[model samples]
Target: MDKIIIIDFGGQYTHLIGRKVREKGVYSEIVPYDMKIEEIDSNVKGIILSGGPYHVSEDSPKIDPRILDLGIPILGICYGHQLIAYMSGGKVGPSKKKEYGITYVNIINNNDILKGLSKKEKVWMSHSDSVFSLPDDYEVLAYSENCPIAAFKHKYKPIYGVQWHPEVYHTENGDVIFENFISICNCNRDWKIENLLDKMIEEVRNEVKNGKAIIALSGGIDSSTAAMIAAKAIGNRLVAVFVDHGFMREGEVESIKNTFKELNLIVIEAKDRFLEKIKGVSDPELKRKLIGEEFIRVFEEIAEKVGAEYLIQGTIYPDRIESGLRHSDKIKSHHNVAGIPSKIKFKKIIEPLRDLYKDEVRKIALKLGLPKEIVYRQPFPGPGLAVRIIGEVTKEKLEIIRKADKIVREEIEKSKIREKLWQYFAVLTDTKTTGVKGDERAYGYVVAIRCVESREAMTARFANIPYKLLERISTRITNEIPQVVRVVYDITHKPPATIEWE
Candidate 1:
């Protein structure tokens, strides 16, 4: 089997390269930047130098020169390009002009990797340094309008380098560029979602082996996909445990019940002990810990009755990556990942979708023929608006945010814009502005609507929502939800700020 090794340099999208490679039916793995060449097997056919937030001229920049001598095909992206130049006797220094966002590249020499792309192409570039001088052994295969060496190839070797990221959708012809690389490298595209499902079933069967499994069915994509997969694997031996936390979004409880019925899976709906657990806690982390502890307790009680020996969760790649489990940034704590109890004795944890991203999970969901309502649903935080609301988790705040979010969705649906955007939702901020209603001073929480356009959740840009749609959403939220006096639209992208405020 052909394999690729992605050397991680702490770039947020380092794992995305591995994901794309896997999607192409090639096995790939992510390793640390400082790992020596001796640690990796020589049988690996290729290496992908991932983009990172480092400058080659910076003190103590990472460089692994030994891999260059292995003669394996190498693809360098962004910072990787800079490092290659700096390490291969080329000079790298600060550029007078910074090429940050989307850049226009003029490919002078159309090489094998640029087969499907034309001479004038737009690629994603994010770097402040340029290769002042090229090494004697490398040739400048491609060049942009400003940058001389937008792409390079080592003399008499299969190593290639690109100054832009092809994994990101922002770059035009990214897919075509990847196809060229895959074809030239002879990577087999055998990793289908259906094949992954078959592999998961086999893994689950071996793990359970005539035993039973318990699942936390939260009606979300992850949980729902996990439940369906587990049921498919072990049939009636799978028992789904739904914890009605009372703080869930509208229609979630009924949604869970209806979905389970349609799937013909045994569901154990656990209600009435959730509210008692989080009585007066206001801190966000404390709230997550409380919910997680209570959830484990409920699962343990149910597992004892069902004799389940394994606990299955809808833990996706983003869940673990965001929770510091993978090569992703440390975002907020997901109840499924960071909220696990100190001592969990129910059974071994199994997650089939743990290595997949959000878009991949949606693809899997669609392949499984899940309901459109569930398949195309917006991304929801596992903590359930607790972190969305910057302050505490009061009933008043939850209701206000929920109504605001509903209005946003309704307006988008009415305007026929819901399908165009990736995710659009409302959040309740702790800031309260002064407003005059009926000649009275009103101080209440502010609601912010976030709409972003992105292919993968790794990077995103602000969505250009129409003003008419915003007007309708604002009007409905103010008229219907009295607690919220002001509604603000968030126009910030993902770099300067994250989707979630907390």
Candidate 2:
């Protein structure tokens, strides 16, 4: 397969770049920044240098200087862009004014890579350094207000570099630029996630074999899909365990059990125990670590009872990425990945969907013919409402947030806009606000509503809900949930605020 090789330099969106390439029907493989030059084969049509949190100095990461001599088409992003310029004798320095998000640039040249894009392009940027002077044989292609050299290209070589990230959704005409690059690489569209179903199932069978396995089925799309795939591989040998840690939304456990009744579903009632464990933990990361460790201990107990030797989880790519990879910084600790303690009892753990993002997992879910409710279900954090309730984990706050989240879902569904949404829920904040109800002064917890639209869990933008709908939701939340004296909607995107407030 002709593939695009992305050299990861610990950028949070490194995997997102690969997912976008694969989204365009071309295979993309991510390798370390120090991957040997010889390891890159002729099948690799092009190379993309991913952005990272580097300032590009003596301590910055590097690729083989021979990479430029390989004559392969190269596209460098943020740090990659600076590296290309600095290596080839261009001057780079810290920016007097940094470009963080939603910046506009004017094109100076109509490069083939920027074809189909307008003269002025809106892009996402998070860079602290700027290329001050161009290298020999390199010319500026675009410039922004703060930086003179926002983009550049080789004079005689098919090499391009951009100071902004094109892989993110915030960039305008990102698809067009990717298509133009695909054309420049002279590649064909041959990659598809749906084509790998059989192979994935076979791998699951090989990993478990005859050993009984317990799956941490959270009833979300990721775990539900994994459960279906694993069940097909090992049949009744797969036990789907749904833990009701007393943090789930109202009636969620019953809805899940009824959905997967055909499978050997076991519901563990440990709500009180989880609340007790998470009590007084104010830090979100600490709460995740505690909940994650408790979940493992619960699974270990079940594993011992069933005599199972392996544990299966619905962990996906975003979960792993946010939890922090060795090369990348930790955004937050996912209960499944970073939250897992160092102690375990299972012989091995299996995550069938670890490599896939949410959208890709949903594609496989449809291929496996999972129920629509399960396939299109909104994403839920493994730590549940514990992450939604800020500051402390209390039964009262959980009840307020649970009812508010339920109201959010009901209103979105009632408005017939559920299908267009990725995930919609309510967050109970620690701060209390003053309100007047029936001429009575009341002070109570503030509830926040978060509804975002995103392809994968990596990047998200706030949904533009109708005003009447917002009015209706706010009215209902305050009216129904007396503890919520005030209701406010979250207008911030993912970079500024995550889906869950924690």
Candidate 3:
């Protein structure tokens, strides 16, 4: 299959670029910015330089010089655009005005990269530097109001650069830009989810080698899908352990148990044990570590009982990147990534979906015959409600947030824009507000509703939920849940605020 390799320069959208490429029916992988060209496989037909949070004037990361000499089509974005200009004997400097949001760019000339785009279109920009002057063989293709060189291309070579992010949804016709670039690379759209499932099953079988394996199934898409794939690989030798951490949403545990009954999973009802481990833990990171360590302990004990040699997890790429792996900065430590104990000596860890994004995992789940509810489940933090509660994590907070979150889900599912949203949940803020109920003063906790829409979790925008739906959710939560006095909606996007409060 034809593939595209995205060189990550610590940008938040590096993974999103790969996800977009995969969505186009082409395989793609993310590698570090300074990866050796020789390490790139022959199947890679194109290269993409991902945007980063660094300025080109500083000690920014660079691509391998050999990559330019390989005769492959290269598309640079934002920081990558400036990097390409700087490396090609061009001038790059700090912009007088930084473009951080939506901006209009006018096409100076209809080039291959912007073939199907309009004469003037809005694009998402997030950079502090601009290409002041092009190299000897490069010319401007498009120009924005603030930045003269919004898009550029080589005079003769198959190299293109864009100062805006086409992989982001804020950019109008972003997919069209990618499609034009893919056409320039002449790549074949042969990648399929079925093939990925078959390869994963075979890989699991080879890794286990006829030994028993245990999967930590949390009833989420990742864990459930991983469990199903593992079961397919080893049949009766694979055992699934579901640990109720006492932090799941309403009906989540029972729903998972009922759904996985056909797979013959072993349910471990250790809610109280998990609750006791995280008692009085107010710090979010500490709570995650405590939960992670406790999960390992529970899984280790189960491994001993089943004599399993491998412990399978549903860890995806975002978890590793957010956990400070690779060349990316640490956004937050996911429990599956940073929370795993160093003292795990009973079983070897195996993560089949480590390189996949959430959407990719969902595709695989559906392809593997999982139910629609399991496959299309909203993305949930591995730390559960511990992170949702901004301050202290207690049974009381969990219960309140669970009830409010259930109401939010129910109302959203009944709305016209339900399918348009990626994930929506209720957050129990640490503050309390005063309200009058039954002609008396009442001080109760405040709840914030977070709803975002995105193709991948790497970047998200607050969903434009209808006012009536929000009103219904807020009214239901405040009227039904006595602890919640005020219900507010969170309108911040991912860059300014994470989907989760913590």
Tell me the spans in candidate 1 whose CA falls farther than 4 Å from its real position. 1-5, 22-44, 53-65, 91-100, 106-108, 116-120, 128-132, 141-149, 262-294
Model 3, clash count? 0
List candidate 3 segments past 4 Å from native. Answer: none
Q: What is candidate 2's lDDT per residue for 319-379, written digit by digit as tens?
A: 8878887578788999888878887998888988887888899999999998888888888
**How do the predictions measure up, each by TM-score?**
0.87, 0.97, 0.94
Per-residue accuracy of model 1 over 118-165 as CA lDDT, tens digit each: 888888777787877787888887777668788888878877888888
Over the stretch 290-382, how does candidate 3's per-residue lDDT look in tens digits?
A: 888988889889898989988999999878877777666678878887999888955478899998888889888888888898888888887
lDDT of each: 0.77, 0.88, 0.87
Candidate 3 RMSD to the real structure = 2.0
Task: Judging by TM-score against the true structure, name the best candidate.
Answer: 2
lDDT of model 2 at position 104 = 95
TM-score of structure candidate 1: 0.87
- Candidate ranking under lDDT, highest first, comes to 2, 3, 1
RMSD of 2: 1.5
